[model samples]
Target: MTRNLILGALLSSLVLLLAAVSFIWTPFDHAAMNIPAKLQTPSAQHWLGTDHFGRDLMSMIMVGARTSIAVALVAVGIGMGAGVPLGLAAAARKGSWLDELIMRGNDLVFAFPSLVIAILITAVLGAGAVNAIIAIGIFNIPVFARITRGAALSLWEREFILAARVAGKGAARISAEHILPNVMNLLIVQGTIQFSLGILAEAGLSYVGLGAQPPTPSWGRMLAD
Candidate 1:
């Protein structure tokens, strides 16, 4: 299990690094068209075959990496940034009206399928990469919040929490110092899961013409074409 986890993490890291590098430099101009070379099979000149439009498939795939990673990172960041805090607050104030409100909001958001929500947001905000990110990010909020809240509730009853309270440490301080550290491992695991979902979501949005705009090179749009 450990070795497998290490291998998976290394592979994911390598992919992310390659994606980042592709943003700065790819083997060829992804948008450049060569009608004569259209649909050419992979060769020395093109590591991957040319597409129907004669764009280098390798380059386009590399460019697509940039879009996928960017959307996933931004979406996950937005979800964690907003959701974690709300979750912590709710956990600290468990059973209060605010806690009830937050959980109910999460449930309401959860009731909508992520794809449907993405479509609605894209329709309202106009189709674009930004809209896709917002949609995915919003969809992820409930997931992160629920995970954090569940983990935090368990930690809140621990001895350290009692000690902190006995020492007169404030709620926010205890949560930040104690609860966050204990739950960070869980968060990291959840973040990785969300990242995978974000990639799928971005691809779906792009396929439907609601994600990256033209010439941006998204895998979803490429598959759609």
Candidate 2:
């Protein structure tokens, strides 16, 4: 596990460095095309070769890393920001109508896969990075909500939570002060999982022509090309 963790971190950091460097420099313009040079094999001039349009694959991969990172990071942020609160609310409320409502809503969302959600969103929003983000983020919401609520529920029955309640804390205060901290580790683990899923979701959307448009490099679109 430790070895895997280190390897994952190293790979993730490498991708991040590549994306950051791409903002400043790349071997060639990702959007520029030389039809004559198209489909060339790897060489010193084009480390990863060139696409059919002669755009540098290495440059495209670098820029696409940036797009994938941005979409996944923002989508995870949106999921945690919105879903955590809803989950906390549901947990605090327990068996109340609010809890039922929130869980049911999560279930409803879970019924639709991210791809289906992306398709529905793109059908209306006309396919773009923003729409892809929305679709992935929306799917992430239910996942985090369910995880948070489950973890929070377990914590609510703990001695610390009971003590907080005994100190005259209300449901919201007890939840904020006592419950949230206990479940943070679980949330972090789940967030990492969701972040990976966000990347796949973005790629799938792009593959289907519902993600970042042309002139923008995307792994999925590159594969499609």
Best by lDDT: 1
What's the distance in Å from true for residue 138, model 2? 0.5
The alpha-carbon deviation from the true structure for residue 24 of candidate 1, after best TM-score superposition, in angstroms, is 3.9
The C-alpha lDDT values of all candidates are 0.92, 0.90
Candidate 2: RMSD to truth: 1.2
lDDT score of model 2?
0.90
lDDT of 1 at 40: 93
> How does each model score on TM-score?
0.94, 0.96
Per-model root-mean-square deviation over C-alphas: 1.7, 1.2
Please write out the lDDT profile of model 1 over residues 1-225, one tens digit for every residue: 999989998988887776878868988999999989999998999988898889999888888988998999999999999999989999999999989999999999988898899989998999999999999999888899999999999989999799999999998998899999999999999998999999999999999999999889999999998
Find the 10 residues in a row with the least total lDDT in model 2: 110-119
